[model samples]
Target chain A: MPQRMARVSWRLLLLGVLFCAAGLVLTARLAQLQIVSHGHYAVQAEDEHMGMEKVFPPRGAILDRNGYPLALTLDTYDIYINRKVWQDEKLAADGAEALSSVLGRRPDEILAALGPDTDGDALVAGSIGYDAGRKIIEMGVPGVKATATIVRFHPEGDLASALQGFVGRDQTGLSGLEADLQDQLGGSAGTLYFERDSMGNPIPFGYRQLTQSEPASDVRLTIDRYIQEATEQALDAAIEKNAANGGSIIVMEPKTGAILAMASRPSFKLSQLDLADETKMELYRNRAVTDLYEPGSVMKVVTMSTAVDLSLVTPNTTYEDTGMAYVGGYAIENWDFSANGTTTMTQLLQKSLNTGAVWVGQQIGPERFYDYAKRFGFGEPTGVGLGGEAAGTVRTSEDPEWYPSDLATNSFGQGISVTPLQMITAVAAIANGGELMRPYIVADVVGPDGSDETQPQVVRRVISESTARTLTAMMNDVVEGTPSHGARVQGYHVAGKTGTSFISVPGGYAPDRVITSFVGFAPVSDPRMIVLVKIDEPQGERLGGTVAAPVFAELAPKILSYLGVPPDAPALVQQGG
Target chain B: MSALDRLIARPLPRPFPRVTGVRPVLVGAFLVVACLGLLQVAQTSSATTTGYNLQRLQDERFATQAGVHQLEAEVAVLTSIDRIDREARGRLGMVPAGTALTLEVHKQPPEQQFVPLRFLSETKAPQVKTSSWWQRLLNLLPFF
Candidate 1:
């Protein structure tokens, strides 16, 4: 009986040992899962259930020199589709159709945009317009989603359109001042991450993460909005009055190289950019700095200035005009084809006598004349910070195409091409005491907190102070004298040159087709501002003095008064001069 | 044993006597823990409110900056030269007339010229005395 009892006890003990071994194994497994591999399992769970996404921050604003908003970023909604959320193909199609109806896009196009052939993670629907996007969001389509994006807005509409330029849908600057200062204007994007609920809505207090977005710095331009509007108005009027192709107007503070106003006609509104309008897109080209033209009699100013500066001729020096001059077997005639005998240098300029300019060019010689032209900022970019600037064509003396006829024609502003900005900036140099100031549109880059970095640059001194003063005096006589009496503005002394260049077509020079241009500074006694107005291919009167000069006369007084510059001279006296 | 039991035994309570001190101490400890938890919740909620307020204030600051910029741009456009010219030329019927006058003069005594200068003290001394009290009162009132 005792042996049997001991055996029973041993059997019990064995059962107990088995139970203990099972408990030890279970504890080891629990330790491995709960402690050793906790992080791994936690990460896997997060990946399957929770999602985090980064949101981009707002871009910067563009301001004028005095803190006027020229370009700005406004929050806009972008509609998108989640294909996975759609219950079926038909539901997705219905959602797309509904979105397309509001977006003004064809149903097929919207379907294609939302179709599942995308290489990206999400299928994209068409970007709806702001109004449409807002309305669609209100409709509350189940699978449709909306994201906020920053879009560039120009508040003044088309004012300074060509200079201020436009940005693409991607928020990148495409042209003009915007393109040049894009880096400074485009601020760094910020990131935001947060935990989302089951409905994919951001939780108010769940794992909130934010990186403060550095808003883009504001780009302050030298352009005065008021002056820009005036310039556009004047240019439009001139274009209409002449019935010309198009026109450009530039106004600059000669002393500082600050472009107060720069305008080009046939411009497009930034808000209405369409890909199909090729002609309108072409009009966005800043002709003042992009398109090259022969400056005509305006070139005479440079020649005369060079001669006078070199002491080759004085204002009182006489040159006998015999209707025309024979050079390189070609006859270069005056505008009227009639000459007054023994005209002084001053009278020659006032009358825009081609032969007189040729005589002056001869005195300057070819090498020195070309050198002076280069010094005046011709045949070079003004470095005005606008993209697609052309450094006008200057036929070099060493080129195989060089001819004596080229020199003779170039003397009177032909056989050479120059952009209007180049001509105006060069003239500005002459008006501003021969300092070739680097013309710039963007004056400074300001931060969101009003701190700023200004890039005010002065290129070089092109001519001596004395020479510049002398040239200003001569140009004063040209505009104030009898022949150009029409260009005289009341209450101001205008120093200007009129250019009537014939357009070279397939045949010789185009008949009745001319580019009439007037470039000058008002209150010439202390030239504060310089202006240039050009009219292309006027139908009726094509004379620079008749067509372009009067425009200058009309605009100068208005601009002067607007700038708060009191008349240097009395109104009636200025008109009489 | 019966006689000893009778001698040692007094009246005993019918139900088991309840322990008083230990129960109260445990209850008090539980209450203290509950109070601590409530305080923690309050502190966390206040911190969250402060954070929300800070965020709201930042948003307001940004909005104000945008408004100021917008108004400044409007002012610039309104005060632009072109608009002024339109008003002056179209509405005022003004044209630029260039007539200048030069006053030619012979040399005169340096001190004999009439100078347009006014002594502020002499001009407004009585007025200043009359308004001094009111000015001081207004200065003392910050809102005014």
Candidate 2:
């Protein structure tokens, strides 16, 4: 009996030891959960019970100068399909059929786009219309989901497409002013945190934190809706009439340097955007700011103005023209290749005499000519607040490839490249009493708090007011006297110059192609607007006065009349007449 | 006398007094716990209901915002220049003015003129025309 009792006691002692070990393990686990690993478990619990959501703000609208919406952001949806549901063939077919019906696509097409059966969701359609998306959601399709998204919509269609630019799939501005002023147009996104239930619904009385989103500022561009429409129509007509490759037209308020209308042809339609087509991407650029071409006789205006400002020559200053002027053994002749015996500075412009321009450049010399060119805002971007502005090339004497012929050619706007915006802004200085103004496209930015108006900014005084007036009179005479002057307004004194130059190729110049352009401002006394029209590779007529000046004539009269500037004295008869 | 003897002797006297089964402190603790449990249940029910209501309201707000966005898009399309031009040319039989006629009225220069808020007074200012209360009530009626 004593032995039996001893065995039982040993068992009890072993049981006690087992109980003690179990107790120690429990205590350690509890300590860890309550102390050492508390934060980890707590965070896991919070994650299960709490939720975070990113609150995206709406992108701003781009408006015209008259507060009409040019481009705006609108709510849309991205359709998604559950790949897990695709495992059930019937459900997948039903979902795809419903989506295809709403999206105007075949069910087989939709199914093919969804790919093989997978576990996660797949995007079926992006930027689906708002009404259709809402209808799909309300239909309660088993495997289909419509998630909210935003898309940029241009109300005016392709009116100023290149200037307004466009947004990508993520609603980010990709080009043009839309890309340039992204900061102001794209507002800051916010975050929201709240406690959620098992089904991911917010708990009514649960803790909530919110970081309020800042709304985007509405940008008002200086583009006048009517003017822009007219400019586009005119450009389209000119391109069709000339059977030309492409062209660009820019109309700016001379005094303020406000771009009223900017249009480029070979532009893609906004309603017909296809990102897959890489070739059309080139058409998406605003060529008025991006394309560089020799301004031809347009630069002669700059040269003549520079000479007049320096007192080196006047409109009456006489130069003997033998139909050819030789510099570095390179002969420069008039556009018609027939020069008058003794041509006045005014008559030089009337005839568009390249020989006469060369003579004037010789008088001013290379150093002062280039200096004045720089002063006139050439060889630099006009700072027009547009993306992809080219600071035109000017090969002055400082460069290695400089030649004496370059000086003569550059005088008449060859061997030099300039964007249409730069050329217009340069001539606008002559119209603005020689004060170069910084050109701007955006006129106002209206935010939630208030509106900010962009005040007119004067770059600098490049030439004297007297010289500007004298050049204006001379240009007016050129317009009135030239036989091919199609830029004349019925009852206005138009100051203008025509340009026609051969397009430069790899080695020399394109044999058959020519770029014709016209730069003009109307009502010579007040000079409210400046217009530049450039056409590339016309099939038949190629002279600026013939091809490009007529386009200016078409758009300018309408613009001036729209501005309510009463007509000045009636135009004078042609010199030939 | 001894304490045990006294107690035995005292209990036996008269009709024997019965002792209560429950202690006061235990009863008090039970009552307190029950009340607390009921209160917790009530608060949870209220909070859950509120959460559902808040969700519904948020959904409504989102729907309204979406509707506003839709209307804005529609208005933009309708007012777009392309649409206007098409409607004017095709539907309304209207053409753009071929000749712009200018009539220069003799008036004060822009700097010297007080234009007299013509646009505001003509278009925006609310007209304070005399109206009977009966007419106003009639105007509120859909048929009227």
Candidate 3:
């Protein structure tokens, strides 16, 4: 009996020890969860039970030189549908139909977006108006939701659209200056944290924390709103009247290299940008800096400037125009296929004589001509602070394709290509007193507290002040002295050249279509603005003098007045020697 | 009146004897419960005030933001070039002047102004629009 009692006692003791071991393990686990790793588990629990949200700051504003806002942000709401809440197919269809009526979207499309297979929420429509969003939310639909969002708005509509460009649905820049200055315009985002219930609804009087977002900075451009509007209106009228395919105009402050105005046709309003339309996408290109053309007789200024800068030729220097010049078996003739026997440099510019240009190029020699061209910024980018800027093509005598005849054709503005920006920037050197200024469109950046000013930069001096003045005087005669040569801006001493080039076909030049252009600067005594008007393929009158010159005559005076420049000309013509 | 008489005379007396320390234990338990109750009331009132303050601040912030947004939108529309031009032409009855600036390029060039070669633009004098040296330096900062 005593032995049986001992066995039972031993068994009882073993059971007590096992129970104690289990109790100790439980206590250790409790301590670990409640003390050792409390912070980690507590944070995890808070994250799981609390609701969080991402808040995106408003994108930056794009303003004109005068602080007029061109692009800005507006508060908007996006409608979404909760698929889980409206799991029933019929309920989902009914909800979609109600939303469709309010949002002006197809009910079938909304239904497909929130179909039974969907697992989460779906956006019904973006940028819904406040009234519309409120009405939809009030419909008492099972799954309807509305969240606040920010959208980009352009109040100026299509004015300078090609240059200002447009943003996407989420305020992402797609082209032009918007694309170039994306980082400065897109600000950093932040987040919000708060407690939530089992239904994922924000808990009333719940714990809340906020990490504030930084607002984007504002960009102020050198584009004067007044000038840009006037340019657009003038270019649009010229395009319609001439029945030309399209056109572009660039106005610049020669001294500052500040782009006062840039306008192109076929531009659309930012608010109405439709990316799906192919034609709209085609018009998205900024033609002033992107399109290339032969530039025709407008190039004569470069050839003449090259010769005059070398002191090899003067305005009175005589050149013989034999109607046709032979170089490497290639015949280079005047534009009308006829030429006067003897011509002065002034008369050659007035008439845009091709043979005269070739004679001047011959006087300067190929080496000097090519060097001057390079100095004038041909065959290089102007770095004008715009996207899609094209550097023109220029070939020297070293290339295998270089023929003796190219000197004649290139001097007369053919067998090479140039963008309007390049052409104007180079010519601006002559107008700006020999200094090649780096052209920029942005004037400064103004944030909330202070402003950052953009100082003008000089690339290099291309000629002496005397040479630029001399060239300016010779060009002046092209408008005022030439008989019926056109390109006259009344009340202004305008110096410019006209170009009419036949559109080059695959093998040779087109017989019918032509590109006409007029480039000039005004108030020869002071030189305020350099203007270039390029019209492509006008219907009736195709000469640069007839089609493009009048546009300059129309735009130059208005721009000068807007800039507050007083008229430098006397009412009566001065009697002179 | 002796001790034996007092013990027998006290009828329906304390079930827990004083010497057993039951009275102090009961009093201590009562005090702890009252203190806990008072602390809970104070905590609840503070949380309520905090919640109210948060809600009011959020509402005020939203209202201010809305006002700013409205004013910004109005400014954008009012400052638009197209709007200004239309107002000038329609409401103000303005007419355009001539199509050219008066300049004479025909005759012999005037005694050339002693035009000097300038490396940079001479149009805007640096002193005209800028502030003090410290202000200019501060303006250069991106987030000044």
Instruction: Give the interface-residue alpha carbon RMSD of model 2.
Output: 8.5
Model 1, span A1-577: residue lDDT tens: 9999999999998999988988888998889988999999988877555555544344566666676666766555676666566536788677777877787778677667755543222435434344556577678776677665556666566778888887676666788777777777766655656666654645555666677756677777788776787788888888888788987888888888888888876677776777577767786778788998899999988888788888898889998999889888999899999878999998898889999998888888889999989988888888887889999988968779899888889999988899888888888888888888888777777776786654556677777788888788888988877754768987688899999998877757886788999999978878878988888988888898988888888778777877767676643422321
Candidate 2, residue A525: lDDT: 88
Q: For all candidates in order, state the fraction of native interface contacts they contain.
A: 0.04, 0.33, 0.35
Residue runs of model 1 more than 4 Å from their true location after superposition: A1-57, A83-141, A191-212, A276-279, A448-457, A506-508, A571-577, B1-144
lDDT of 2 at A408: 98
Q: List residue ranges in candidate 2 displaced over 4 A.
A: A1-53, A93-113, A129-140, A192-210, A570-577, B1-40, B103-144
Per-residue lDDT over A30-142 for candidate 3, one digit per residue giving the tens place of the 0 to 100 score: 99999999999999998789988777777788998888888887767787788787778788778877888888879888877665555677776888765566576567677
Kindly list the per-residue Cα lDDT of model 2 for residues A324-359, writing each as its tens digit.
998998777887889689989999999899999999
Cα lDDT tens digits for candidate 3, B1-144: 689898888787557744867888999988988888898888888988888887879756754665576579788999776787789999999876645434446566569655565754566645656579999888899988
lDDT of 1 by residue, B1-144 (tens): 888897679566589787789988899999998999999999989988987887678656655654554565466556555566667899999875553343333455578546566633344445444568879899899788
State the weakest 10-residue window (summed lDDT) of model 1 chain A: A118-127
For residue A322, model 2's alpha carbon misses the true position, in angstroms, by: 1.6
Docking class of 1: incorrect
The superposed Cα distance between candidate 1 and the true structure at residue A375, in angstroms, equals: 0.6
